[model samples]
Target: MIKKFLLTMCLLAALAVGGFLYVKQSVTDFIAQPLKIEQPHLVTVERGNNLNTIISKFVDDQWINPTQFSTLVRRFHPNLTQIKVGTFEVLPGMTFEQALNTIINGKEYQLAITFIEGSTFKEWREQFKQAEYLEHETDGLTEAEIARQLGIEHDKLEGLFLAETYHYSVGDSDLDILKRAHRKLDVILEQSWASRQDKLPLKNSYEALILASIIEKETSVPSERERVAAVFVNRLNKRMRLQTDPTVIYGMGDRYDGNIRKKDLREATPYNTYVIDGLPPTPIAMPGKASILAAMNPENSNYLYFVASGTGGHVFSKNLRDHNRAVQQYLRQLRSKK
Candidate 1:
């Protein structure tokens, strides 16, 4: 009877070991199963989501079997159960274990949106409407209301945001990006103003922003920014009307059909520098760092006027006579091209 009891105990121990190995192998196989992915897509693991809930999402979506993949995380890979909150780019051919590891330890995918230099706030808003994975909370809000929310008392919002590439995750808002740009512009503008050259005609950082916006619209060549700034600065010191075409365009608003007419220039508008004596009511466009720096410290030159050279640069002049000649030259070049 004792010998019979010993044999029965050995049989029970063997069956237990066999059950443990079968479970371990099953978990390994399920973890190695290829994830179901037909096309690339974005997946967001929201806050307070656990591994079971996440796996259930896959199961509900028919991407995996509930019974085949559930026990693997808790029984074998306990670390994968500590899933993180992020947006991930799930691609084709990833295994179940790889996807979990990506959610747990891999870096979240980042998308970028760029605000081009010389763009207006309206243009930026239009871009916000079209951006993917970004929340549009500022839609339908007026500029004044938006400013109040951003803690700004400024009358207008143009040229407030810096022109640069900003990165964000799936859940970020347009206001979040705007706030960062505004803060950065504030810091940069303050630093530039504090170290500005003495005797500048600009009264404050706002005026610098206004001038910088014009400079940004005037030239795209990197080498021409300082010289272009000098012409505007010299005109400001001489009390000459800015007579800039961009200001006329801005004043016309939707009436501007990509062409500036003499009648449009003759019209008296607050933003039309040809009619106004000083900088416009606000900045007309977003200016970059170099343009801001140029506005703060212009090159020391006698230039008072400039005209586009048709070759992607400008012909600067110190007097009306030379400026008129350059204008005539530019007209001739246009005629020759035509």
Candidate 2:
């Protein structure tokens, strides 16, 4: 009877041990399994969000099982309070551990600022000011002062910053961002200048940039940049005025109330191409890579004049008579449409 009783006790103990082991294995598998998220998702933890709130978000987003997620968070990330708040890209099939580690490890969020070709400095400033992460304030610096801060000698920072989408950290300063952009522009310009076609009309790389700025302002169409550059190149070769309206607009400065009157065109300012010969004293606006390349290697043409075609592009001509005809055609089209 005593032997039978001991045997029964041993069997019961073995069964209990086996059941405990099975339960442990099940829990471990559940916790370790990768959570497969099908769609692209953004997880934003705003500043000062607590650990419970973050876990709730994960659970609600179907990113994790609540109990397993809570266990992992409590065990591994006891210091969940230290997680920085910002946006994070959540990839598919990432485990809770992996996501938690990513958020806690200070991975920077990249946001892009796209400066379109031919944008003025004023426009660029406004865009940067309006950016969510950037701090906006009254810039007490004059144009000259801003240039000085940027380490450029010219009063105009126009045509210096290359137009492209630049990535930045969450709270990068405006000055620092601009400086980095200028540095990038310098490197690209140097490379382009070195590989340029020889014996062009430009005196130097700066002169090339000036002409490129003109091309950028003249047309919004990518196909017309080279042609516009060609016209300006022909004029430069012949020592003729560029006669671009963009220059007149630049010369008007702050007083420019968005209208280019006949008198504005006729008025002689340093930047007025209609009134003065050769390149302007400074670039009117920033040029993009295409315009810069076009200026460097203009399409080989005898074109010396162009006028807006009222189709958001320009009509190029090789001589004065053809240019006048294009002007009349564009004017008539404009009047008829109005």
Candidate 3:
């Protein structure tokens, strides 16, 4: 009777050992096998999704063998029932283990969009419209309604969103991106406004933003920003017409045929700083951080006029007579080039 009992125990132990060895080999083989994907596959694990759902999704997509994958997960990572919510990219020829690890680690597949400085709000909207991954919530909303939706109380929406490259996951809302940029602008505007010099003609931070946008449109050179800002500041202090061609072009709208004519300047519009006093109603384009800083801290200069120096920068002057001379020089340079 003792021999029979010992024999039974040995047989049971052998079966257990055989089962363990088989499972170990199966797990190893499953993990080592590459996923069947010709192109990169995107797997989105939403919140509240379980391992079963993930496995089913992969199986349905034919990314993995359902039976083998289930066995491997059950034996190796039984506690990994829920994957973190994110979109993971499973590249072609990656091993099953590699793809699974990427999903488990929640490495999101990020998309990027850039808003260029000096680009108008219209251009910004066009970019948002073209972004494939962004969910368009504010597409049909009016500009004012869009501002309200973004939690901004401003009457104007132009130059409100900061220019920067923003990263987002798939299915992220465009409104969310706009909100982030707006908040960034708010933070930067406040910090810059707090550090501004005393007794400036600007009424508020928004006015500074407007000036910054003008400066941004004026020049791309880093060294020229403060000088150009100083020109505008000097003009504002003297209650002189900004007479900036950019403002005139902005006011001319469809009438501006790639050139600023005498009529365009003479035509009265709210945006035409030549006709209206002080800053325009709103910013004409998005301003970068450098422009914003330059607007707040303009160089101490008596200069009131600027014309393109033909070297991708501007030449500033203290009076209209000098400005006219600089303009003549600019014309001579243009004629020479032609």
Off by over 4 Å in 2: 1-99, 104-107, 135-138
lDDT of 1 by residue, 1-338 (tens): 99999999999999999987887877777777787879876768999998887888877776665565365668687877878899987677988788888888878988899999999999999999999999998999999989988998795899999999999999899999999999999988999999888999999999999999999999999999999999888889999989999999999998889999889889999899999998998999999999999999999999999999999999999899999999999999999998
Clashing pairs in 2: 159-286
Ten-residue stretch with the least lDDT total in model 2: 68-77
Quantify all predictions' global Cα lDDT against the true fold.
0.89, 0.78, 0.87
lDDT of 3 at 96: 74
Model 3 agreement with the true structure over 214-311: per-residue lDDT tens digits? 99998999999999999999889988988887888877776768988777788889999878999999999899999999999999999999999998
Best by lDDT: 1
lDDT of 2 by residue, 1-338 (tens): 99999999999999999976765665455446566688746667778786667777877867777663354445444655466688676677777656666677747566678888788888889888777566443267777888888889878788788778888766566777788778877887777788787778877888888888888888879999888888888888888888888899899989799899999998989999999989987778888888888888888889988898888888888888999999999989989998
Clashing pairs in 3: none
Please give the clash total of every predicted structure, in order: 0, 1, 0
Cα lDDT for residue 283, model 1? 96
Q: After superposition, how far is residue 10 of candidate 2 from its true place, in Å?
A: 13
TM-score on alpha carbons, each prediction = 0.96, 0.73, 0.91
List the candidate 3 regions with Cα displacement exceeding 4 Å.
1-16, 68-72, 79-82, 254-257
